[model samples]
Target: MMAFYFSRLVEIFPFFLRGLWMTTKVAFCSLIICTLIGFILGMLRSSNIVFLKRLIGTYVAFARGTPFVVQIFIVFFIFPEWGLQLEAFPAALLAMAIMGSAFICEIVAGGINAVHNGQWEAASSSGLTKLQQLRLVIIPQAMKVIVPPLVGQYVLLIKDTSVVSVIGVMELTRVGWVTVVRIPEGLMVFALVGILYFSISYPLILLSNYLERRMAI
Candidate 1:
């Protein structure tokens, strides 16, 4: 039975393979972009600057609270009147970055907060500048706490590549949908999609567990 299924999959293999490649590209690109955005927003939110914190807080709040689909629509359609126009792929990528970044930023801030205050006080007493304290002391310890969440965020970002395909970005899920339209094997196609997502995420989950153990958190 499995052989027969593999034969059928082989028949439709190119479409799925193309889809897989697109998924990889989208996920990898978006992950890198989201990482930068997340780190910046995370740092800004933790900044001692008052107004900057509130502004960053509002952005994070809206990104976190709203539905991702709405964000995609707003950026792709509604923002056009303001003379900002992005093609489907860039728009989808932006949406993914924005949504994922907000979550990542929160994860970072949470990790930072988890560090004991005494560490900061001790660093300050040692005459360390804020940048020096962060670079030398707080960041290293916060990093251990942050890894599990950041890894989980990366997995989530990869999973999110599917949602962007809804806007016709021709990534994995979009390719799957197109193939299913031709083949009319919705269950098989979707099942394969689930398998692909699981294959990537499960390994990350294991790695996260290992890091958590090593960090002793």
Candidate 2:
């Protein structure tokens, strides 16, 4: 039976590949969205402005404090009542964006804050506008501190794609669950799922390590 199920898993491997593609798309799109929003919010978060900082703080707190699954449910199930009807894929992406951006925001804020205050004062003395200071002087330096953990967060985001399966996203983990129903080989099915996940995340892990070393210089 084990041999038969193993062969069955091999036979349906294409199904898993399709699921892998979906996961990739979700992760890629979410990464872009998270990075953009995270950077913007992070800049605001590290800013001296009291209202913007507190407002973003509240959002970051809520996002970090809540379970991701609950966030998905709220996006997928609750939003319809508010007259925002989103399909599963869009809803999954939205939930991912919200959750991911918050974490990334904190990472960006930490990175920006790590820059010496003298650097900011120097930039100001150079007569660069605030935006120019961040773009030209601050962010460039912060990238060294930011890139490693940011890559690490990306790995976590990719793995978190599995949670979207609860909203019917048909991602890799969802494929594994469906395959288990047919193959009735829970261990075999999920083991393959785990391998696929590793394949996706492992590259980012390598890149993170490389960035850590390179950035350390």
Best-fitting candidate, scored by lDDT: 2
Residue lDDT tens for model 2, 92-201: 99999999999999999999999999999999999999999999999999988999999999999999999999989999999998888899988889988999999989
How well does each candidate superpose onto the true structure, as a TM-score? 0.91, 0.98
How many residue-pair clashes does candidate 2 contain?
A: 0
- Superposed on all Cα atoms, the candidates' RMSDs to the truth, in angstroms, are 2.2, 0.9
The Cα local distance difference test for each model comes to 0.83, 0.95
Cα displacement (angstroms), candidate 2, residue 201, comes to 0.8
Query: What are the per-model numbers of colliding residue pairs?
Result: 0, 0
Model 2 accuracy (lDDT, Cα): 0.95
In model 2, the clashing pairs are none
**Tens digit per residue, CA lDDT, model 1, 146-174:** 88778878887888788887678877788
